[model samples]
Target: MRWLMLLFCLGLAACQPRPVKELPAVSASQSVAELYRLEREHHALSALADVTVTRQGKRWSVTQGVVIERPLRLRVDAINFLGQTLFQMGIDGPLLQAYVPAEKKFYTGMATLDNVQRFTGLPLALPDLVACLLYSLPPGVVESAQIIETAQGVDLVLAPGVRYETVFSSGRLSGFRYRIDDLTLYEVAFGPVSAELDFPRRIELDVPQSDTRVVIALDDIELNPVLSRQQFQLSLPATAEEVPLNEMEPVDDQTVEH
Candidate 1:
């Protein structure tokens, strides 16, 4: 299996955004507690959203009209640059399926309930994988975090390596900022945590190496809409070919989603 280190920002040191005014210093223990509460808050919500993924590359890059159903399914309706859905993935509990419409590719695999836990670093799963790309390690994400007043509302700045910073108001994750190495907010996911990630107003990815930037702006989103099993079922055309999991290229991102 040739697993491509899809986008691991491993070599870089700890990343930070331009810092704002400092708040009272929070003890590591308190930070951890706050982060845990936020995780619980995040997982409890369900939503449906339209997402766009942009990769700074020449051959293929931008993707739009991606859909995500909280705590499960993800559908890639279209991709730009490639100009088609290069891949689609869905998760129903532990069962995961990925489809490549362009290659007529289909795959089925087992995913543990704790897949996200074990895959805290650079592991991207269906549905939530997109979110992970924006911020790695959800449940145990915050080694330490502090609730501080930002220009907007309270923002949580997690300590340690990641350049992940989030803004929340009324317990909903309103905005987020993340970077890989020197990358400028390479990934961003936004929406009310009470609902699924359907309201991603903007998404951008800049790959300086490729000298390209991909941006996706979302205007409308639907949440928890009834969907048929067929929507998530990985049914391939009779002529569709099979792509083994071992054969499929791996997307490696040390920070989860680079």
Candidate 2:
């Protein structure tokens, strides 16, 4: 009888499930540079997007083409549904220029953050703009960082208020969220990875602060394509009046309500 009881206990133990091992916690000791390196890395890209801009309770929809080269070179063109060019803007490190055909005006100034904000209505510097568009972190000194591991993936809090959450699937970065002080600054969700480019075929950007959202349903996307310097150049008509970017009025409610 004792032997029978021992055999029954052994059979029960054999049928019991084994303990599941927990995944190792994500390391927080990664340096800022190392973390940035792990994020999206791209040299140059050209994309066409359907952009929707909302400001002061008004929304404007337009088709935009963007070409970007690393460090600080970008060109953007906005076109209306009528196939008319609304505006063309470019920045090459230091020089910034924009041509508004509707206003028949040309603007030029130093490619400073304030100037870029005045022209583009986006309060981001050249590098930040590029990073935002490319779904990556901007190149800057990170004051501090904290790593939070989640079932979805990991969230890296940088500096005082910026937090970047990277969603992982199959051990790959599938999406990202950029937040400032708990407010979502931007969110990007990528479509399937393209075999030719090894990047997402579609990318979406949502900016809540400015009430702006852009969906780049990439009909065609190229990575590191051969591009000429002239592609980043914009020429205005000789008769076009040049205006200073600083002199532009605020597009938000901060402007005087006359």
Candidate 3:
């Protein structure tokens, strides 16, 4: 089976799927068009979010201050209670930088998927993750989607023979699924649409491929915030030792959410 590399921004995943329903269907051109339009207009955002990661029944949750922009830029500042920095990560262009306060170490490397997975346990390149945060399709997506009517809704197949499916329920995007042959790699289910932002308030990114599930809850989300290039830069204390990513080992880091 072909590995489509359908990884979403920051290891988005699918949830435990309910039974596929054979419900009545209708045309969703307007809603679908609006979704795409929103994507096209989206450029940057800065927000505070609650991220929870569940792996094999163990859960880790944290609040993060996140800033991200288009064309491969991201910053995630994970802090502990009482407003202390726990870990910080940034990606600008091809460079990835992170600082762990507990370890008093600074990490830097090319923003490759393997290196990223080693540090964050998220098997995704920078672009894919940035797009995932935009609530848009990752790069290399074939825009010519084939919409098939189902028992209850429609499935938008983005690539032929790729088994990457985008499902819409009642004119709203409900989830994205990737299945190769009989094996399903993931199904990312979206929470309810936010009335103010018109986006999913939460996303359940259950990436079984990595044995990790991440659920991202967005409460104070702002779109297209005024931000500059310097926003993606990571700052570390001078005392922190700098290390290359290739020399590091993978850690079961605190993560969970799409």
Best by TM-score: 3
Best by lDDT: 3
Name the runs in model 1 displaced over 4 angstroms: 1-65, 79-88, 93-95, 109-144, 150-163, 167-174, 179-200, 205-214, 228-230, 250-258
Q: Model 3, which residues run further than 4 Å from truth?
A: 1-28, 118-121, 142-160, 251-258
Q: After superposition, how far is residue 80 of candidate 3 from its true place, in Å?
A: 0.9
All models: lDDT? 0.44, 0.68, 0.70
Stronger candidate by lDDT (1 vs 3): 3
The sequence of per-residue lDDT tens digits that candidate 3 reaches over residues 159-253 is 65555566666666677776666666766777887767867778777777667788888878898888887778877688999988878755445
TM-scores of the candidates are 0.49, 0.72, 0.79
Native-to-model Cα distance after best TM-score fit, residue 14 in candidate 3, in Å: 45
Native RMSD of candidate 3 (Å): 14.3
lDDT of 1 at 197: 54
The 10 consecutive residues of candidate 3 with the worst lDDT sum are 249-258
Residue 256, model 3: lDDT of 23
Worst 10 residues of 2 by lDDT: 249-258
User: Model 1: which residue pairs collide?
Assistant: 6-252, 46-196, 47-196, 49-198, 133-257
